[model samples]
Target: MNFDRKYLVWALGYLVAGMCVGLYMAASKNHAQRVAHAHILLVGFAVSFIYGIIHRLWLDRPGKVLATTQFVLHQAAAIVMCVGLLLLYGGVLSEPVLAPVLGAASLGVLLAALLMIWLVRQSGRAEAAA
Candidate 1:
């Protein structure tokens, strides 16, 4: 299987952004701002970069139903987590409801990523067999 350098770049960018956010949070005194920045860096940059890497590296069946389903689930979770973070930062969502919900969405994204990796590995094995 061919490797994509773009995924590496994307992952590095996310790590850098997350680190920057950490620095900013360290300097800030406000709790809310720190929380918001942390979520943005974690979910927006970190999760997104990971997703890009997964998409670039994984070479599963082109039109498989499971592949499509996983992709949709992954994207959907990412979107929801991002939006939820934004809402929380904007003070539109209370922590009691929003934080847990966003956390759950992020978990879904993680699960999807795992499933995609498994599918890609299976496909690679099948190709080797053939």
Candidate 2:
């Protein structure tokens, strides 16, 4: 029910999907889905799990506005990036649209990453001062 648990669940879903993709790729001997498989496993599963762990460990403000911002931005960007990558890799989307979509998604991820860095730095300072 909590935000952290929600992320963990999402990560698990990604992990299952990624595993399925990997299995399919292996069985078919087709590596066209390599990009999607990697992103699904790394960004979707690994990053989300890491995000959940960070939330659980850093209990400064569970669902504060900044936390909410980071969560929403990161999730939105991840979805956008994953979808864009999938479409592009599968030739479902042309370069014109894919370029802008993936570019914006990358920027969004960068912003969210910066916010996380700031949070970690803040926590580090607090711990040091204590």
Please name the candidate that would achieve the greatest TM-score relative to the true structure: 2
Q: Which pairs of residues clash in candidate 1, taking residues 3 or more apart in a chain or in different chains? A: none
Off by over 4 Å in 1: 1-63
Candidate 1 residue lDDT tens string, 1-130: 2123433454465467556656765777445555545655665566556655655656634336666676567657766775676568658978788978888897988887787677777878877988
lDDT of 2 by residue, 28-118 (tens): 9988889988998888889889988887787455437777788789888888888888888888988798999899998998898888877
TM of each candidate vs. truth: 0.59, 0.86
RMSD, one per candidate, in order: 4.8, 2.0
The deviation in Å at residue 116 for candidate 2 is 1.1
For model 1, what is the error of residue 119's alpha carbon versus the real structure, in angstroms, after optimal superposition? 1.4
Q: What is the lDDT of residue 100 in candidate 1?
A: 84
